[model samples]
Target: MATAAGFEGTLAALPEAKRELARLMLAARQPVPAHPAPRSGAGPVPPTALQARLWRRERTHPAVATGSHALRLTGPLDTRRLRDALTGVLRRHEALRTRLTGSTAGRPLLEVDEEPVLRFTEADLSGFTPQAAAARTALQITESASTVLDLESGRTSAFRLLRTAPDEHVLILASHLAVFDGWSSGVFLADLAAGYREGTGHLPPPELQFPDYAAWQHRWLDGPDGSAELACRRAVFASDPRARRAAGGFERGHLPVRLARGPVARGLELGAAEGATPFMTLLAALGVVLARREGRTAVVIGTPAAGRFAGALEGAVGQFTTVVPIRLDLTGGPTFRELLHRTRAAVADALGHQRLPVDVLFSDGTPPPYDVLFALHNYPAVPLDLPGIEVGQLPGPPARHLELYSPDPAAALACVGLVERDGEIGGTAEYNRHAAAPEDVRGLLTGIEEVLDRAHTAPASPLTPRH
Candidate 1:
């Protein structure tokens, strides 16, 4: 059997900062997986459409790390135990330990490492006041997110544990979108808690790894480009005025959308009925809001579809969410119930025809195909059941694939993300700094909630909100 002393060479070679963790590693005698996975999984790592787009951006701005999830955790101090838990979690999930490499084929590929290279950075904020420490905590988060996760160099995830005082700490968990998605974040927390409680070797390996999903997606998308399956795609979206592709592409007369300032975030909570499906009513409300904002009876907005259409992928952590266009018409001022009925039907069609990647669906569209995108976080509220450590989600800014848009309105969409958590529905309205004003998004967010409330009360009447 392998012993802790056997790991001393590996741990000693680590930077001096991780030396304390070295002690923890030796003392705990945490066993590695009884069945260590192969150094690399079979087949080429499937390049997800979302990753393709994000990778393109990363090639230019390697520092543009997007997903920084932090927790405002306060509890007893057990540094050694926590370090073991972190490594244990990394060892459990292949997705968390996988790296990305861009090939001349112009797509980023994945490589699963035999073991996780954990980098845990710690800071003692003992001297600073609570207020100053809070400021410094924000700076640390920014610094943690400043550098992109370079997979070719063999890294994708990072940890920042700051001790504000003896029993309190701020934990910032981060990962690049290349492999991590919003749902994957929750999965990581659940797995972290599990690995912390039980030995890493005890946990069952995932029935399906992310690479499996990637390979499946590759074969699914590699089929004929034009098929009868997508016949309904173009027809269902015919309600939009811009459905007809103009000759010579989009008209040059369109003006660039400008944000009055850099993107700012706003939050709101509106009641939702338990009977209503996750995003059906919420997205229906957004459709109504967009129509009101543009003064157009016909509106088109993009919403995310979890793409976990398969049972095998429910627990896997990866980039499986994709966006699809949903068109709604408020013509003749239909009743709220009537609008929802229409919204449900349109959304159902979108979901049914969403097999094509979002990028592929809109790559050929003129004027970028959509002006606004909505993400209803139908996320599982997985709690971190760590002993003595009260781990809660750090909800800030917003989480959405909206960043994929270009700065020009003619090319990108304004993205808004919403979630219903703990009996309250709230989230951030994120707009591009160059295309749309933050203040406009704030007003739009408020207006959206108002419409949602009105819909809940008066589903039979036209959706014209009373001031």
Candidate 2:
């Protein structure tokens, strides 16, 4: 037997070949499993054709694990009333409880074979104080554990409500983004409130179920030239050199800046008088932020555009987002309108090249090194009203984990997620912690907002607002 440090001493003395031999010997000594991965009920047969394709693709890349955003609220409410209301929400949304499985060859995918049941349980707070119980329950949910509520003490909650208040009464909920996006959050909240009312006998059933959207997506994504669109997508995705590499040295992932918080200074919008488009306004605002931060007049910003140019893929879920490069150059102390024009032209160029993949582009040639990544999402429509319950909207959840991890702060990118709602546009700026500090990130957004306010609030004509 080797002494505590004997192995290290022996290895240092031996030739590299001998060292390799010892490592192989140790590995061979370890037992190997005879089998892996258990197969169960063959779960939900692909209910729709689109789902079939997803199941096949996911066979190789298992659907990314789902995560939840939780909220805690304290209020005086009825338990039976809440449980009944929840059942209604669960029954309405099919994607909420869906799961998937497929063969090694990646066909004959399975889905809807078994409906994942709705989970509604209570916690026991018999011994601990109310606050303690609430704290325990919060941790339990955060750590992905199921808990039973002690209804007797006021420990009742749902995993689907988006917002909550804690103190005398609390309501909590969790949602998986795999089936929901930012746009859907607003709709879900509207419906939940309506659903609650219906549950308490305030109204009738909802006009439609989530499955309706599923059916619509199937028809929409499978429409004509959808294959062509995908071909173009392949082209774009294949263009990037870094994305094309067989391996990357970066660690799998470790999330820094876990939660980003700050007031959202007002956002930018195209006024009725101006012939400005939302994309143009967005690019202009971001250009200001970039210019302010880098102390450079000309800036390059990269944003992801939904490549679903064809209406067919409109409802087709899955990650159809593409990274498009937007370039904004300020020349001769350009006026706000001139700045806007430059921004718009850059956006057009990006959209034109959106078909090319980032990996392919990098492989062919490197992008001018500078600026940031700007992603704008025009997500699909989801139902906003359920038959019962009052739903509330909360701050978007912070992404705790990212797989495409990088330690190099200036590794040539920063992503800003922007979404336009009604007429107001709001978004979050995501940057590598190693590259951008929280204060710096906040300042960047503020600069954008300041410019937008300056432009929009100024005399409706060419007059700029007082900053």
State each candidate's clash count.
3, 50
lDDT of each: 0.63, 0.44
lDDT of 2 by residue, 224-262 (tens): 433355455445434322311112322222122211122
RMSD after CA superposition, every candidate = 11.4, 16.7
Across residues 1-467, which tens digit of lDDT does each residue of candidate 1 receive? 76756666666688754664454334334332212122222434656666666766666667454578888667885777678878877776677777667556676776678777888889999689989988898888766666468656666778899998778888887787766777887787788777767756655667777766664455445444433444457565544655322233211121122211111111112222323354766666667777776677878877777777666677777777777777787788887667766777887877875555666555554443466777767778788787877766554433434554322233443566666555555556655554555566766666656666665556567765224
| Reference-based lDDT, residue 216, model 1 | 47
- The lDDT of model 1 is 0.63
lDDT of model 2, residue 141: 51
RMSD of 2: 16.7
